[model samples]
Target chain A: MPLMFDHVYYTYDASSPLPSKAIEDIHFTLNEPFFCGIIGQTGSGKSTLVQQINALLRPTQGKVIVGEFVVDSSKKKMKEIKSLRKYAGLVFQFAEYQLFEETVLKDVSFGPKNFKENEEVAVEKAKKALKKVGIPEEYFSKSPFELSGGEKRRVAIAGLLAMEPQILILDEPTAGLDPKGAQEILALFYDLYQNGTSILLITHDMNVVLKYCTSVMVLHQGKLLGMYSPLDVFYQKELLSEAEIDAPDLICLVEQMEKKGFSLNRQNIRDIESFVAEIKKMKGEVK
Target chain B: MKALPIGRYTNYDTFLNRLDARFKLLAMILFMVVVFIHFGSRAMDFTFYGLLMVMVLVFMRIAHIRIRQLLRAIKPMWFMMIFLLIINVLVVQTGEAFYIGDFPIHYDALFNTLYTFVRLILMLAFSLILTATTKPMDLTYALEWYLHPLTFIKVPVHIIAMVISLALRFIPTLLEEADRFMKAQASRGVDFENGKLREKVRAIISLIIPLFVSAIQRSTDLADAMEVRGYDPNGKRTRYRIMHFAKRDVLSLFFLLAFFGGMLALSICGIDFYAFIL
Candidate 1:
């Protein structure tokens, strides 16, 4: 069963005379291992909605049902929540700030340690997670703070992966990194999702959303603007405009081509890989 | 990440923001001491309280900010207030030093215990006023300029002032980062508050690790950038905005002195008449 929210709403300070609402009436559900992307402008409450999913934020006036837990209602103890944590791993924007270990190994071991895993076994899991993130074994003993920006990002992810969460949420994971760095991280996530890890990618990078996310959600000024299959969501130009965002360039290009009498679905335009693949498919069909 | 500040003091200026840094600092200190020392002796707390309200009202009017905006700034401190209250009442063990199932009831401990509780609330309020009325940059500069005389003995007042101001300025940013870290951990099912005290403390340590790391990194980068820009920590630098106290500032200083002097005199008289001193 997927995680669902029923009429969720949240504000920064509820008691304030004029509360600054972060999100409202956010309703959505996600089955396991879905590669979903959240797209919105600067203050569109995109982060707020995703935050509620993992119980990072309690809904001000609604229910957040993640698997068996009903947050803001359930009498479940902290131990019960720890098990839930094992299922959902969230990677924050600039997650590098979360790194406070003497060594990369020690840092990644934090999540497993929290679950009361044995020391040796936690190290084993940490090693595997680190390798998966492309960090060499030699870097295991090195302090994580000494690593480069991209390395720090991977290490942060490794820290989360050590928990072995089935559902992973990453917020703007590739922001402030180079294009190559962005692609590498996205590819890692894509592979992970394909291998059965649920992924939530919150980003302003439309290309990342369109290219990798199987589902797309749009938020605007603390409201659930819309959530749709990526293809369907990509064509709503007016909606995107109102949200102070733009559709993927490829999405627009394909739509413009369709408008000029070329019959096309105007989807699969997020990544250059898909860009080439769609053109090839079209040429073959024409022949 | 920039922290959201909520209060009547906006970054932009008015007459209050333009006073001599030293005068403002001295005035604020003297005012706070007088407020704490004499607040209990007043026959009409409401009138004095109303006077404070009017001052805030005047401050808000001049600074072009609304008093209504300070509501959010007052939220998070509630837990602390209640915590201190409970500790005050339960820890003193007076009033027959009795307990109802290991809970102590105290009589004489009431005032001594609750004194700090209310004192902090007012202290924070005034500090908030200080912060709300002044931008982080201006506050730091003011302190540096005000404390410049201390450097004659080789104290490096400018450097000390800079460090403090930098730390103060980044408080909100660090808080925001810490909050995000907690949220991220929470999503993964980490219940920070639901565990044993040791466990909760460990969770907090885990949360602070990244914030401090980022802080060190930012400062290192800042140091490098400053060095590259030909910035000299020890060298005298020209300031773009000249610091000066105008006629309004002189009047404000007089008001501060009069308020403090009257409060001191009132407290002395109160002690002579009642054999008590606040």
Candidate 2:
């Protein structure tokens, strides 16, 4: 069964002097093998919403069902949540810092060990995870902090991938990486998604959202403002503006080109390669 | 071990920050006692007040903390102030009883209570200023030095100091972690707010379990890291961040002595510092 939330209301500290209502009566669902992008301006409650799926948060009102697991306002956290986390690996922002083991291999194996997997199987899982993240097995013996920026980030990611979770949630996985590194990391999401893992991707990058996401959910001021296919979502300039977001440069380029007497169609072509194709076709017609 | 105010320390280069935190600590505790315990006799209280006024001036000069700001800091304690006012005026009726809707107010007891509350407010204000001005680790070091003699009595003073600083250092991190965990739980359909006491506790426990797990995981990681880094907690340690009191610190100590003397005189003379008269 897919994860579902019904009329979830959440607020922080009824007694707090600085009042805040993080999420209010929000409803959403995530189906299997889904590569979903959750984009929001900061404080739009995107982080709060996605965290609820893995039992990291319980809705203040209403109910949530993740597969057979029934999470109501009542269910106290059990080993079930731990099991859920194992099934649904959450790669937190700055997850790299969670690396506490002396060696990268051991650090990667930490979660599986906590899950009570035997040492051998845990190590094997770690190795597989490292490989999946494109890290050489030899680097496993080294300290995680010793790795360069991109490599350290991948190692941190490898730690989550090591658990072999079915539903993988990554928050801004490619942020703060070099351009090539960002491309490679985003491509890694494609690899993970193709392998039948459900992915909930939280990012601010319009380019990342436009490219890999199967469905896009836009969050604004702690509300689920809109959900749509990539092209439909990008064209709504006002919705993007209200959410304080921008469409990718490629989308902007195509739209700008359309106004300049060019009959460039954006459908069946949402990438730079397609843009390139349309440009080359135009060049030929000009000749 | 929690840093008294984890994220609230003000940053400025002033005399208060320069003085030996040990001195401020020892002197403040003594000053606090003078304010609270010496309330009955108005004559000696006058001397302590004179001393506190002098120390306040020296502290303001050195710490770069303003007296006006410190007084304003007491604004948040209005609830406590009201509680004190009521307790002073009622319950402990030492003199004439005034009735308000069948509740009798003891005028003399009320007078003493307000006096006591003012004393506490001033005491709390002084300590708050000290904490708000000094670094937690610095304060820990001050406590450690003050309690160094306890080492001879087998107290493991260093361990206590380490625990305090580490606790202080971790508060901000733990708060952030708790915030993240709460968000994560919320997304999962765990409601932390809007419930009866039992239900609220249940929700909080859901949040706390993860926080506890994370804390333990962090501690485990820290243990391993410390072992790898060759840290022997039981072993005598070298100081990377050394503590040295400057000449200004010595001058501040002298100022502290003057305050200490004045508080002694106030307690002997029987005066209420808050009222500026007996």
What does chain B score (TM) in every candidate?
0.73, 0.77
* Model 2 / residue B174 / CA error / Å: 7.1
Which candidate number has the best DockQ?
1
Query: What does candidate 1's lDDT look like per residue over A183-284, in tens digits?
Result: 887888898899988888899888777777889888888787878888778677788888888777777778788888777645555667767887888899
> How close is every model to the real structure, measured as TM-score?
0.77, 0.58
lDDT of 2 by residue, B137-205 (tens): 888988888888998889989888888888888877898887775554432333565556875675576
Please give the TM-score of chain B in predicted model 1: 0.73
Proportion of native contacts in model 1? 0.58
Report the error of model 2 at residue A11, Å: 2.1
Clashes found in each candidate (C-alpha, N, C closer than 3 A): 5, 40
| Candidate 1 global lDDT | 0.74
Candidate 1 residue runs with Cα over 4 Å from true position: A73-79, A177-181, A252-287, B1-24, B32-129, B150-157, B187-191, B197-201, B234-252, B262-271, B274-278
Report the lDDT tens digits of candidate 1 across residue range B1-278. Answer: 22234443455666666666656667668756854675433343334545655665676577655554444455566787677667777677655555669766675465554555445544555565666666667778878887788888899887787688778777777777777777766654456767789878877777777667677878898789878999777998778877787787788788888887877776666644233432
